[model samples]
Target chain A: MLIDTLITGLVAGGTYALVAMGLTIQFGISRIMNLAHGDTIIAACFASFVLFSVFGLSPILALMIVVPVGYVLSDAVYRIIMRPLVARAPNAGALEVDSILVTFGLLFVIQGVLLVAFGGNYTGYAFLNTPVDLFGTIVAANRLLALLLALVFGITLIFVLSRTRWGMTLRAVSIAPENAPLVGIDINRAARTAFALGGALAATAGVVVSMYQTFTATIGVIFTMKALIVVILGGKGSLTGALIGGLLLGLVETFVAAYIDPGLTLAATYAIFLLLLILRPTGFFGQAG
Target chain B: MNTTVAFILAAAALAGLAIAPLFLNAYGIGLLVGMTGYVVLASAWAMFSGPTRYVSLATVAFFGIGAYTVAVLSETLPYPLVLLCACAIGLTVALIVGLSTLRLAGIYFVIFTFGLAELIRQLVTWYEVNVTGTLGRYIFLPFEGIHIYWQLLALAAATLLLSWWINRSRLGLALRAVGDDEVVAAHAGINVSRAKLMLFALSATIITLVGAIQAPRWVYVEPAIVFNPTISFLTLIMALLGGATRLWGPALGAIPLFLLFEWLSANFPNYFSIILGVFFIGIVFFLPQGVLAKIEGLRRPARKAPPENKERSGAA
Candidate 1:
């Protein structure tokens, strides 16, 4: 039972890390909290569901369509909503508050649109239903597959962020936006790229989630909050911090569910989050303000 | 606007509302009750968030605690006493939370409050599950619609008066200074943390009273219902939509917003959320300063022409 719980917790944490990566990058670049990030994931899940149920396409195949669509949609949201707020704000602090409110508005808008389109039904795909044995513990094949994909994407993100010129530009923009422009890097283009990449990563996580879990339209906000907790716990802008934070949260939640009442899991998660905020606001890997 | 004139006008409006239920039917009274609740919530929210510049998403936490306190105490105590208990409970919890969280800046403060709210909500749910063996409790209150309406009106009036007083007080100046720049305020001999904590407790007290007043109308007290995120979002949106910076902004925003919500919910229930979502986004993008601010802006040049002399003198 302990081994199974450990495996399950690690896998869940891996998926959470995948989602947190997108939030970390977006926040690092634009300082927008992106409350709509989870809704974008929900949108991708719905896309995969529609494609699978109607056209008999696999969720993996649906990703090719969802990622680019997510990119465009997120970019449009940033341009139409966020850009105006940023332009109006007098300083970075004001911009942060404005962005949070604007993103919250975007969250409701996305959820409303999804509700209109899909109603409030829980949807999932029944793929890879076989059980697999891993070191004396039995697990679902789809969960393992989801974890594998999350890891692949997560590693690729780290690689790209560290090794590519585009990644360097993004890092520069995040660290010193004023200096990035002085160094001839087009800050706007880098920010736009960050949004697109963040959207794609969110969509990828969504596809993995849809393959393994059932979800409804309203569930998006909870996931967004959870992802935010992971990001904050891991240290806001650090990819490595996101990984560690996700794992810690997942383990705590899984253990609480196993030992205590399942209903108390969320409560326990939030309690830990609050304690962490009060005691160590910088999180595990974040720089002290 | 003269402070004394605004106070009188607000009192007169409250008096008019107090007598309105005598002629109106049950549906109108019910609508007025909801509007009054929003007025209290929005104004109290503006009181704290406006001057401190700390955007809190914890309204639901105090509100839920107040509601549950009423549910548990209404059977044993008189209604007025129960309301006071709710305020006490809210103040105690706010004091504890504020002390721990008041030192964080901006986004960190916002997230911590939000987390605290979610924590309280979950804890309440857990208690209900383990202790009560049911999701919620039903409370019985012996009050008519008019009586409840009057109580709500009184609460709303008190909130408005408190807001007006705060806007004109030395505390308000210190709070505004803290909002503008905390370090500067600290250097200028203001106890910034104490000011923030006091306002936080005061805001929570008002919100809790509003919840206690409205709890009987709900009939049932559930963690999910009382601690609903929608309440927090609505209060925040209404306050911002009316211009939180202004004393009367929340009332101006709440009346139209409550009416529109009523109309939309009754007519096109499925599309109501979508419309509201669109409205929220539109307001954020186009009317961030709120309707009151926009109106004030149009008349600012005329007002400022005379103020230029005062500004030069102040600068000199």
Candidate 2:
């Protein structure tokens, strides 16, 4: 039971980390707290569902199509919806407020579209339902595959971020936007790229989630809240923090539900989030604003 | 508006509300309750968020607290005392929350309050599950349709009156300064943090009472229903729509919105949310200063130009 719970927790946490990475990157670079990040994921989920049910395409193949579309759509969103706000904002603080409000509206729009298209019903499809053995514990094949895909995407992201020049440009833009331009980097292009990258991650997370979970059109806000928690817990603008924080949240929730009351898991998660925030205002590994 | 004219307008509105029950049917009075609810909430929200520029999403937290307080105490205490206790409890919670959270600035403050609200909600749910074995409590009160409308009307009047008084006071000046620049406000010798906390607590107290007044209407109270996240979003949007920065702005926004929503919800329920979303985005892009400013601008040509000396004195 314990081993099964551990694996389950890791699987859930891995998916959460995948989601939070998308939000952290957007917030870290473009500095827009995209409240609609979850809507992007939901849209991707519906996309994958359609590919599988209608076109008989596997999720892995759907990834190639959905991810690029997410990137392109997000880039367009930044241009059409966010550009005016960004142009008018007097400072980072104002941009954050404007972005939050705009994205909050975007969230409703996306949900409305999904509702009109799909109706408000829980939808999922069977994928790799066979049980597999991992460290002598039985787990669903779909869950294992989802975790594997998340790790591949997550590791590749970390490697590219740490070892590549493109990654260096993003980090520079994130850490010092004013200095990045002085160093000859185009801040607008880099921010646009970062926002797009976050969208790609949202698609990736959505594909992974649709594999093993049932979801409704209006449930996107739950994912946003959880991602927000992980982002704040891990520290904003810190991918590594999101990864570790997501994992910790999953494990804490699982362990608490197992040993303590089942209902206390949520309370435990936020209690720790609050305490950590009180102690480290910027988050556990968050940079100074 | 001048003090005399504003007073007359306010009194006339109150008188209309007082006599409205006689002419309106029960169904119409119910609709009025909905309108009053939003106006009170949006106005109360503007009282603090307008001046301080702190976008607090915790309205439902104190609202739920007030409701839960009444649900637990309505059987033991008098209705009036129960309402007072709800206010006291809401004020205490707001002070505690403001003291801890007001120190954080920008997005951190927004997220902290959001997290705290969710935390409170989840905790209440957990308690209900583990201790009570149920998720809801039935509330009983002597107040019915018209009585509920009257109480809500009184609440709205008190909210507008208090907002007007504070906007004219020295604290209002200090608050606007804090909104524009916290550092400048602090350096200029205003107790920025305390001023924010006071208003935050005050608005929270009113919101709590609103929840209490509303609880009997629900007849049943639960964390899911009372602590709904939608209420937070709806309140924020209404205030922003009318312009949170000005007195009477929320009411201006709330009245037309309430009417429109009533029509849309009844006719095209599926498209209601989509239109609401468009409304939010529209307000930000087109009317950032709010409808009041837009309306005020239309009559600009009718007013005579101020004397040349007025410009030198910084009067418009």
Q: Which candidate's lDDT is highest?
A: 2
What TM-score would every model get versus the actual structure? 0.95, 0.94
Model 1 segments more than 4 A misplaced? B115-117, B302-316
Tell me the lDDT of model 1 at B172.
93
Best by DockQ: 1
What is the C-alpha lDDT profile of model 2 across B1-316, one tens digit per residue? Answer: 5989989988998999888888988889888888898899999999998877777878888888888889988999999999999999899989877876787775766766665566777888888787878888888788887887889999999999999999989999988888878888889999988998899999999999888888888898888788887677778888988888888899988888888888988998898778778888888777766788667766685786443211111100
lDDT, candidate 1, at A263? 75
| Predicted structure 1: lDDT | 0.82
Chain A TM-scores, candidates in order: 0.96, 0.97
- List the candidate 2 regions with Cα displacement exceeding 4 Å: B115-118, B301-316
Residues B11-122, candidate 1: write the lDDT tens digits.
7877888898999999999998899899899999989998776888888888888888898889899988999889998999899778767877666667666656667778
